[model samples]
Target chain A: MSETNSPSPMRILYIEDNPLIAFHVEQMIEDLGHVFAGSLDSFAELQKQFASLEMDGALVDIDLADGATGPQAAAWLQERGIPAIFVTGQRQVAAEHGDVSLGTITKPVSSSELAAKLELFR
Target chain B: MNTIEDKSLPALDQVLILAPYRKDADYLGRLLAEHEINVRAGARIDDLARMLHPSPGVLVATHEALTPDALATVAAHLETQPSWAEMPIVVLLDRASRPDQVRAELGRVWPRARLLFYQRPVTAVELVSGVQSALLVRLRQRDVRDHIAQEVELRRELNHRVKNILASVTSIFEMTRRGATSIDAFADDFRGRLGALDKVHSAVFHSEGDTVSIAEIAELTFDPYRLSGMDRIVANGPPVTLSREAGTTLALCLHELTTNAIKYGALSHPDGRVQFAWNLSQDETPELAISWKESGGPDVEEPSRAGYGTRYVRSALAGMFGQKPVIAFEADGLRCEARGVFSRVAGNQ
Candidate 1:
């Protein structure tokens, strides 16, 4: 069992659309000592990283650039055995797709929640 | 409801950073890894969504990472989505000390976006704080929306149950009236009662549970026999919706007249017919006059005793119109006329 307070080093790929949220979440990821595999906002960019990078888990948002949503991104990451968390500001979208097993962090993600979700990958 | 904690951060995993702009993307990734975030770098936004596994908890994107058209596309999708969707964006802005400039830019492209404006050369802590704050807001918003959805669903269930109860009551009325003595004679009486209820229901339905329509009373009263091809049953009136009680009363009055016609007046014969017309008489006074005339029926005379139908008609119409209806049993046919005051509904007037 992963402790919520002690998150282990894990590779993460983040896909979000808001800059301020990305900046804050990125800071929290580092503050907690987690490794960020990559951050993306579009499907095409995510695809490129999948071809090359090794990742432990992923955090995705449903809305993204280039007409790519977080679910589409999570699907790709799931195929690679990379655990993905949805960091979203929209609760309806989260609950609508809540049946999925992946972790979901509502936006304005705190360092604590991000760390807690990242611990699942460990 | 869950809060992000400092102890949860981890390090040592390889991270691949992906962003459109070189300076901000590399800076964000390095800043995370430096805090022991364990990060790698990716080249573009599309590759990050498609290829990255166990997707990253935080995605960092600058204006340069996507074309303006692409950002616009993302914005459009966001509009349809709930408030907590974590599509976080960290727009790398030129360092401007003034708040007015920042506000102006916020009004421009980031109007409703959950964004953090990072002036050039953002520090590691500031970047981390910005990202965490944005994500935190997303979490709070999610909780609120969930609460609202639950409440909406409950209200709809309540509405459904209420409709079921009313339907059950209607069934009882139908069943009880069917078993009464003199079923053929009771048919007209039963229909009149049912018509009264229908008139009330129609009035209430329009106000969404508040008022009714006078025009509905006219329609409901005449609707049943409209297909009978009786040219004498003519109706001419201006349209107006009334209160629920008012509509029911008027409907009953009309029902009584029609029943009388079928049994003893104009409608009892092949050539007999009834002419009905009503209109608002004065703008300032706000009164209405409705006339009903029957022609071509057997010669008529006053009955020995006024029945329940007559009393019902008089009471119901008088209450709504503020006066008893003028009723005449002529030798050739029966004619009835009524006058009353009515107010216009707010929106219709």
Candidate 2:
């Protein structure tokens, strides 16, 4: 809550297939004192749309609507200077491709976890 | 380094022969070949490491081939064998060679190897049968290896699915809590949402192709009212299969709509009615459109503040359809309609 008063909110994009998860995390990003950059359901969407999306960072899920393309998407985002952290239940898979992500916040993400992890962007 | 994660295993069909004497190597290779066995008469010890890549099913070694260097190489291969592997080694010794001494020493040298000893005058039948038995053992090991791989894959998939379900439930819980006005309201809302999620999940699981049809979702969502002899709400639609994810989202939306109707919209009053209908377009890229209409209810009014049901339906429908839906609060009742590409959410069909 230290950042609540002087909330330097980050516009965080969520790349997840499940709308409910995306919505929940979107609200958490806002509650944790960050901005929601919006969401995309697949890596293909991110490829086509990243140029227009204004985001400081991203929370990516391992599985998306297309397939298990989250790691590749993270690497692509990294090349564009947009840092990403994995928001996944498959932490081992996320860890295997650790070079691309800042870190991972496991699913069923708590508000506290989102707050601390979002600070890494600053 | 091969573990349970190895996508493919080395073909263990060849019997590798280690014999320093050219005569012995040729004789053994020819004999094994005559028995319809694949034999690689590896003369030089230097090439043994490369040959081990596609690992041999059995190792046939003569007494003269047990040089310190040869033993060391074989020992190293044994050391690196995967947990399921136990390479069979048949050592042909001199007539006077004491079998116990050779077995004991080789046992210490290659602890993981299954060793068989034979005298120099052994018959072709004896040798072939022994090698065949060893090959059979190797085949069993490969089966074990495959089983382990399958188990590992199944466990990982199960873990991923369980985590996904937990994440989904947590999302529902948090969102429900946010919309909840009191503890009692929270419990009711949460339980209702969970029940809807569970029912849809069960339908998808029971159905072929991991899909749930639009009609099935409608039947499940409106079953409570229909059972109560409430003729106010009706679901009418052609058979349209939806992918599990799409089915789940739609089911939840229906739940929200159904609950709202029961509370304040249509089904709350005897005269009020709700029409839930869907259609598939006949275009090249077919689209699925669903509409919810409520009528004859108390004077319709847009809420001063949109609650969870309204917000969820709007956002979720937009996500599914790639277009915003029109949710109008007419003077008579509430109306919601959305249209989207059917291909985007179609099941196996």
Best by lDDT: 2
Task: For residues B180-269, write the lDDT of model 1, one tens digit per residue.
Answer: 457775675666666666666656677775465556666667777876665467777787656544554566667778878888888999
Q: How does chain A of every candidate compare to the true chain A by TM-score? A: 0.83, 0.94
* Residue A14 shift from truth in candidate 1, angstroms: 72
- For model 2, the superposed segments whose C-alpha errors exceed 4 Å read A1-12, A28-37, A50-122, B1-8, B27-39, B93-101, B104-108, B117-126, B206-210, B230-233, B236-239, B271-273, B279-284, B295-297
Model 2 lDDT tens row, B16-132: 998888988898899999988988996578887777767899999999888888889889988998899999999999999888898899999989999999998999899889998
C-alpha DockQ of every model: 0.01, 0.63
**Cα distance off (Å), candidate 1, residue B196:** 5.5
Instruction: Kindly list the per-residue Cα lDDT of model 2 for residues A1-122, writing each as its tens digit.
Output: 23455356688999999888987887677667788887789999899777788999999999987899999999999999999999987899999999999999987788878888887877
In the range A1-122, model 1's lDDT, one tens digit per residue, is: 12234535666767764332343454456557776554555666678647777777778887765553677677767776777777765667766765443668865555567766777777
- The docking category that best describes candidate 2 is medium
Error of 1 at A25 (Å): 71
Report the number of the highest-DockQ candidate.
Answer: 2
- Candidate 2 at A55: error in angstroms? 6.2
